[model samples]
Target: MRTYFLLCLSIVLAANALSDNLVQAADPAFTHGVASGDPDRESVLLWTRLVSPDSPELELTWELAKDPTMQTILKTGTATARQEHDYCVKVIAADLEPGTTYYYRFRQGNIVSPTGRTRTLPRTAEHIRIGVANCAKYTGGYYHAYDALADTDDLDVIIHLGDYIYENGATRPGDSYYPSFLATGRQHNPPHTCVTLQDYRTRYAQYHQDPELLKLHARYPMIAIWDDHEIAKIPMQKSPSGEPIYDAAWQQRFNDSLQAWHEWIPCRAKQGEVIYRDFQLGSLVNLLMVDTRVCCKSKVDKTEASLKDPNRHIVGDEQLAWLKNSMLTHQATWNIMGNQLLFASKGSDWSRWPGFPTDRNQVIDFLTEHPRINFLITTGNAHNPHHYVVREKESSNILLHEVLPGSISSGNNTEKSRSNPAKLKKLIRAQESNPDLLWYNNDAHGFIVLDLTTQRALVEWYFVTDIRQKQYQVYRAHKLVIDVR
Candidate 1:
């Protein structure tokens, strides 16, 4: 018994000594980890941040490898991490083979960043699987959905619709509606609502520090777009009365948010250009990501005159023209529209595409006319799962399918509905009013797994059992198949 006790004491002392050394050696460098995104056939964007408090600028080296060990280097280059860009570095690794997975890492001195894995879009693929997610509030719950997705090795890519980071502050200590106890214990870095560029950057940093999200980024390539929360609530650039709403300060705020987004997100867009771009996945999918917030018209009231206004547009003319051209010319098996707003016509919801009835009608008409085109619209910001069929107005024929993957960690509609029974009843009435709504669930938090082939596209909604707990099971809450061929 004495010998066993001494052995345990020695082991504990050794562990304590090792932990002390690790703590002493720990410095704030590469604090956010590494991420890769915006993958093309022969190129991918790599991102990393060097959090060097003592240095304003630091030279970093990045290498791309074909193996996880990084012994076989395919490409290497040097980048500078400056304080102006928040010490973030992004570089495009070009001239790579299509459909090939690559490993990447960043190094500065003896410190090495985490290795990230990314794959380019295939020139020809018989099938593709993508994970769709959005609306991850830092104070909402645990990022169990992201952890599950990281473990899901079959996913080719991740499509993030919007609300990647909420601008809201930490949840109050003792709020009944959003109790702090129910939160995942992750708080916003600023401890207040984000209003400045620094605040937004800090919020993003807090989100990036999440282990599950970091793991997801390290494993799969992500294509993301920002919704309202990244800038402001409601994202009203103009008032309802046709006056410019964003003042000079607010405009500056918007610009700062844009800069931070561009710096942090590995999007392949030049400065001052819009983020709406098209990606081709062999002959299987033509993914068109649209930016609906930046250049959108003012949010109008639900008046008939406002809805019928010819000038009101959801997607600006340039993006709309690009979308039309892509739709008309694409020969892929699936035309996937990665949108930020809810595409369905909610009776009085002026925040969505329904507010711009003219543009909405034009898109609907285009889809109706092109019956052979397999159109699939994946949208976010609803915080709940919504599967609906977009039908023609006159003939009531199905034009396409709209799939809304529930939020990653945001509060579900069920909780809100429970708090307000009348609102829930009204939502049910709205669903009943629309025959195009195939199914709707407002009580779950999860993501959608989209599997596509030459013949059809299958969408499976996976719901996390509990977001408050780190360990949770994802159950297939819903599944739908659309004949694409």
Candidate 2:
């Protein structure tokens, strides 16, 4: 425990002493820390970015060990961090044992990165625990939630739903919802909304400078998918022609943002930029990570005619079909959907699953007919915690459960409810308005933990008391136990 606190303190002090660009430290230093993710039974992806005062590219050796002391080395390899990849190195430590914990670190001469802990997927398991989180904007507040998650020792992996980094400037232009977004004494580097690759990379670097986020990354493997804010909310906008625009400029911007995402996020190499993937944790859990915001989504249309249109799909035909197929193929005690969009409706937000009524009904119908699948859809983007029940074909019989772990630090209704009586009334009225709302919390900064077993699954929400201060307390505010299994 003393060692843990010292490590965290060292990281925070190092972050506090960094320059504006978060660079110019040593000859070749690990400024952003180490992270590992996308683990299979045999391999897990390891990542770290090097900051140098002289060289644009540096060679470093990474070692994975069975113990924390780095005595029993399992895998050792050398990698070159080049300027093209923003000096980020991602390498797969293959031939690892299943369900085994490993420690990894990068070294260049005398410089050594902070040791990161990671675990590969289990070949056979009776239980598993995962942390779920989303919507952490650097300008919104401090990342105490991430620090709290780091303190959780039982987590095997963390699923970042989306909005990992908000691309909005200090002020989001004409959007009245966030006139001056930077209220927590934090600022975005580059001082504008991300557009080009450099802009996105700069934003990611700024977020990386947070000691809490860095500590969380080093402590646990993260499975992440991008939301609208990661790419500057591109899919939400439409041109004057009333049609979704995919012009040349948009394509370039998308490519740039995606490149930055790939550079920063540690994940297994797929065919393309596809992040919608599945992970099987022995026979206990099957995690279906789907992209509902970016890869295959259309502009949001709230009109009744478009809502129920069979052709208008928020998840698109290809991804929806893949989602259903993946569930069918990968059977486990719990089938958890890592959804980026809200599955339940919240006020007039048509961007939820309700926006595509036909597809939503189709998914529910498929789950209903199966009858054997114990399903849970985990989503975010609202920055609020929600618990909802979806019925079987709108019948009395329950079909599936949906949950939002709540946002890490993105701007939520806390200030609005505190300042305005009408907003507070609406928050109260919101729960009263919906019969499916089992629980709702509009004001909080936190993360969720999902524990899965053969008999039941427990989802617990942990909220921090304050994000304005680095030192705060975190408590388990709510818990939902799904015993349908």
Candidate 3:
């Protein structure tokens, strides 16, 4: 641990020096670049941050065009980057055409932000491809996955499953939990777990300045939801062994993190405090995003009764009703369930749906009852990729199909089990015991591409060769096709 921290110290010192130089720059600059997200048929949200003279607020004008060039500007507006909001600007350019692409840029006087491209949801569609990715730890590896994702031209939108930025303490060299942690010369911004609003904002800025992440964000609009790391390991998380830490200032930290999330992430949340919402992708898909990480999850207790308790809700009651209603009500070709946690029961992993069997069965029962819903689920959090034929039990009928894409940068199952024979055996045992688990990759660092058409949906697992270095090659490692009948 001593040597691990020494390496961390060096990376932190180097990063801080670079950060100091950027902070001292004079003229106004769009240091983090531009991004767009929360796309709907008529409008989309555009985002950028400006570094300038330390003023209370700065007004910036934005223009949206249908073309890459600014020759024919479609929409123009102005927004303010206030000091309280960490000098970030977000604007919703509304009343645009459906299924249309728009290019936008922000200008604070002479300094113009990079132009970003975004597209609105279509009213009708025969084919669409959506990219799914999660678990990008800045210290764990290079952002090569993001760079590869930015190059995919066929993708329409991206869904981030969580762990966008880890709130954990600074990573140490040879960190076992992550592959190649701190080998890429990147360290957590504050070099500590985030406990304040500024900490969270600074962490986000660290990620935003990454060229690959900036490139991807500037290209496709993202639909993101938080998982454990968003509020995990920080001011309000449990102890390492899952024991509650009352001194964490839980509520305040939670509030601060969520505030920063709303400010930095380009999401069009439907309610003030709710992140559980659905997006209609023309007639092809209805993307129902739910909050399993934070909406209302009872603390984990290992007792049999506690684990099986109907009252110990992980997804809560109201969200269940909303999920069931949305699943039943949608008329699209596919009702895609988006979760930060896998609804599948991975035997010993109680943090996911398996922890609350009652609620897991409840969701399973609803899907079994409504067979016509044509349900499919995309889950994240696990670094490895997983494919499941979701069911209540081995004998139970199929409830829905679930898929977990490989992490964008986090360590894979192979990395964790490499030196530990028992760990590898445990995963093998779990796989042998669970028949519903069709397949999962023990090793991979990549993303998932979901291709949808009226008759079928195809999940392509694209993986990168290495994350230890900046340059790497990406390839489609696996593919699964689901027939929608």
What's the TM-score of each model vs. the native? 0.91, 0.91, 0.90
- Pairs of colliding residues, candidate 1: 414-442
Off by over 4 Å in 1: 1-28, 173-177, 180-183, 238-244
Query: How would you encode candidate 1's per-residue C-alpha lDDT over 295-401 as one tens digit per residue?
Result: 65566666777777677777856677888799788778898999988787666668688777777877887777777888899999889999988777887777789
Ranking by lDDT: 1, 2, 3
The 10-residue segment of model 2 with minimum total lDDT is 1-10
| lDDT to native, each model | 0.80, 0.79, 0.78
lDDT of 2 by residue, 1-485 (tens): 21322323344234334423346555677878778888888999999998766778889999998777788887999999998899999999999999888889888898777787788888998878899999997776788899889888667789998898888776453443343253455777778778899999999888887878887887788998878888877564443233547778887887788788888888765425668889989988889898876666666666877765666666776787988888888788789999987776665657778777777887887887788889999988878888988766657676778898778877677644544668778677877788778898878889999988888999999999987665799999999999954
RMSD of each: 7.1, 3.7, 7.7
Per-residue lDDT tens digits of candidate 3, residues 1-485?
Answer: 11211111122123223333454568666777677887889988898887767677888899998766667988999888887878888889999988877778878777667777788988887888899889998877887888788777667789998889888777775566444754566777898899899899989988887877877787789999988787765322343334555645777787788888888888876325778888888888899888876656767778887875667667778889988887667678898877987777766766778777777778877766667778889999888888988764546766678999889877777777777878988887888789888888887888989999999999899899988886799998889988886
* Better by TM-score, candidate 3 or 2: 2
TM-score of 1: 0.91
Predict model 2's lDDT versus the native: 0.79
Evaluate candidate 1 by giving its C-alpha RMSD to the native, one decimal.
Answer: 7.1
